[model samples]
Target: MPCLARWLVLLTLLSHSAAQENVGIGLDLSVGVEGVLPSLARPANASRIFHGIVFDAGSTGTRIHVYTFIQKDPAELPLLEKETFQSVKPGLSAYADTPETAGETVRQLLRVAKKAVPHVEWERTPVVLRATAGLRLLPPKKAQALLDEVEVAFEESPFFVPDNSVHIMNGTDEGILAWVTVNFLTGQLQAKTKKTVGTLDLGGASTQITFLPKFKKTIESAPPDHIARFDLLSTTYELYTHSYLGNGIKAARLTALGALGAEGLERKVFESSCLSRKFREDWSFGGLTYKISGIPDGSTGFTECYKEMLKVVKGVIHQPPELQDSNTFYAFSYYFDIAVEAGLIDERRGGMVKVQDYSIRAKEVCNKLSMYLATKPFLCMDITYITCLLKDGFGFKDETILKLTQKVNNVETSWALGAIFDYFQNIKIH
Candidate 1:
């Protein structure tokens, strides 16, 4: 089929773009959604380039990814040439009460996109914001309020705003897209032997695990929701993927302290064995405030902390039996950040580490709290939780090797890059 003809048919099904409302368009690529992004073919001497602006509305922060792609060959996938990235702290969910402020945050990030993308191309570029666990965990009304404000911001921008461009993203798509990002950048997608690695993303409010299962029993024994079948570039992938809500690092902290969803947090104090006995502080997450402290005179160490962390993971995360065998995985986001802090990986280059490395580091951090009190009060709890999540939650063996990294092939290893492919397939580049 001609490239123009393929996009015309896709645009018809995506006609909701004209409504300009905050609708949740499920890009369940699992159903083999075809390309909708325009293709431009020119003389061999001329080069065609296009841009995409994606806002990752995560729990801890909001980041803008301005991606520039060049179509060197009409017969091949576009090459990702460059990415201009910027971020702002305190995600949209923090402004749940004052929704207008959430809109302003997006507007602030738009300036980065404005500079990153050429002015002449502004009218043709498609801009979107996909809120993750942060907004998803918020109350329905509050989440909608934030999305409404963001939509208003997009409307005021110079860029093209597609229909349902601003909305909360489901976890299933989050995991699968992230997997696509890692595999795509590593050149695994085009290889003859499709030996792609799994992905593990630990955010502030949720964590996701996704991988292509090699054995038939892996898919058969899995829950129906855990299996996602999607086609990309004419290749079908049956992946085992799942995102654990309220199981992110920050949310897990509250659960370990017995503060998650607790009523009257203002009047009560939540204490945990995970922290030093002398530790006391106020923690804020998902727009709620809670006073948390450690036991005044109770024993504290890896043993006590591990017990608390285990409470949040045990029986909560489904352990795929196939994962017990050796398999490669690219762990990022919090996984990369914490690993760097624990000295298990290099801060710049990143490196490989076994699942047991986290446990060993967690024990060291927890056993010697005083050494890290000023700079890392929660390092003990945070690291221990990661250790528990991998072993007890996901059932990874101690010898399981994980490649921890912030980027692959110079592209930030994130679902944003994988997600932009859909927008590229849907929008007209001209």
Candidate 2:
């Protein structure tokens, strides 16, 4: 049999058996639903293919992920066949006042989905959009308006549009889903294993840290919302997860300038030690723009930048005791981007570096500010903040290693994949 045909047969069998076991199809927010997985039985045929479209409406950009999966057998999880990913700039938050334009962005990305999935399967492919901190930061009414606009676009698209498909995801759910994505893609969730790596996601408006707590004290000492519990593949996991708003690299930039949450942006010129002395720019975030520049007639360098970052991160972030010890963490998004720009990691393959490495690089970059200022002025601030965030904020020892990466197993590292998994298990039989 040809490769495609053989795979189809296997998938059909798996889907059939999964249906018989009452597993049902679709992703579920609640883990291990009752009667979800019973004893598997052979089906009449074994060839099934499905597709899921997930839009990550992040603070900085809106990204579309088209995922294809094939179920090989009832007893096992579906295998990912391929992924098609695309992104648009300025994020959905930028369209706060013009939600219709945000919806248009969604409409444009759906074209990619239209081309990726088979024409016959277009109507069957489920499409979902989950906005993160960007929309969450917006006024409730404005956020709802933007989501409603996106829903209208999804409804008009030639794909399966589920109810409540467009909404702002809570920070806790965001962290949990990202943890799932990293663990699942890294093969750490297979065979009921206990070993799992942690995840650190640095976005434009917020940052998330998630890991399984091994000690009871860690969970006991944590604030109520700082901890989350969920089950994946019949195993319950107690995870320490938190998303810090206004702490993302971009937001941190504002905080360092004393512009975050400040009123009357029109007359204010926020100064920071992070930028080059001569560097000045119009920075925009979360639907607001500001004039930001380095301290004029004042100091600018690693020392000054570190102090500015300290005010933004120190004592603002909860430092769990567990982080002091050695732990494996996968850092992505801005974490990966800055590392690659600093020549600390391979852009394509990624690489590992210790917490101290960021500190070292920040010093090197900040010291030679004039040389790199022409091209990447924010390099000094970004690296310095990341170093502070990992060390003083998260309480990671200087020796703690972080695997800076953009993707795992060729899949982009983000919560979107985990959201896809959740979407699949929740597919109702009706």
Candidate 3:
């Protein structure tokens, strides 16, 4: 049988067994189950096969994820076949003044979805766009305008566009969704499983740390927003999650230079010890450009960079006491990028590194600043900031090991998949 026909036959079989039992189908990470809500239950005749399009409007870029899923039976969550992922540079927030242009980016990426899903299923495939910290940092009017333009473009598409499909996602949801994605893809969501890994996502404008806390005091001591409780399958998880805005690698560079919120970049020049004495560059972010360079008169190296980064991290990040204990964490995005570039992990296949390893590498890379600058001028600063962020900012002990990976089981480690799972739960298939 052909692919579509075979899938349809499988759906028929699964739908017939829909009433057997409830299995994990993901959950709204931001919302707690107040005694088992109806939305949590799988529909009696839920479709076994489906597709979803999720657009991650991150600070540095916009990425499209087209997912194909199949439920083995109604009692279990849908299994992802594969993800068609593509990204474009200069995120939606970059088009603050040209909102329409941001919409065009989404329109262009939708082509990937068009080619991936079957033509007959186009109208049933739900498409959504979730903007992250980039949009959240923009002016209210500008952010709304960008979202509005994207909604218009989504409406023009043949795929099904749900209400409020394009909007800025809250920080808490961002952290929670990412946690769900990592745990689910890692098979930690299986029933009666206590082993779960923490997730550390280092984006361009913000970073998030999320994990299921083993200690009750961890939850009680955490700020209300940092603690998210939700049920999946038959188990309830209280996750210690928080997104630190303006702490991302790129943003940290700005912070280290003391240029994050400075207005009128025309006359002001920001300097930092993180850069080499001869280094100078004009970097742009969040619709603003600034002239930044190294402090010509001051010293530059791992020691100097660490001191500069300390000002950006110390006392700013809430260090959960439980984090100091040994635990497995999967770090991705810029974390994976820097680890691979710094020779801490393999480029194709990721490896493990400890918090102390970053410090050791940062010192080694910084001491030989000339060689490191030849390959990547910012390596000194990037490595130093990462070390501080892991050790001082998040309060991870030097011995804490982190798994640096770009993908888990071939699926990219991101919140897009988890968001899709949540999307299907709230939508009614007519």
Single out the weakest 10-residue window by summed lDDT for candidate 3: 13-22
lDDT values, one for every candidate: 0.84, 0.83, 0.80
The segments of candidate 2 whose C-alpha lies over 4 angstroms from its true place after superposition are 1-46, 426-430
Clashing pairs in 1: 36-425, 36-426, 37-424, 37-425, 37-426
**Number of colliding residue pairs in model 3:** 0
Best by lDDT: 1
The model with the greatest TM-score is 1
lDDT of 1 by residue, 107-219 (tens): 99999999998886676678988999999999999999999999999999998888889888899988988998899899887673568899999999999999989899999
Question: Which residues of candidate 1, in runs, are more than 4 Å off?
Answer: 1-44, 426-430
- True-structure RMSD for candidate 3: 7.7
Q: Estimate each model's TM-score.
A: 0.90, 0.89, 0.87
How does residue 72 of candidate 1 score in lDDT?
63
User: Candidate 2: how large is its RMSD?
Assistant: 6.3
Ranking by TM-score: 1, 2, 3
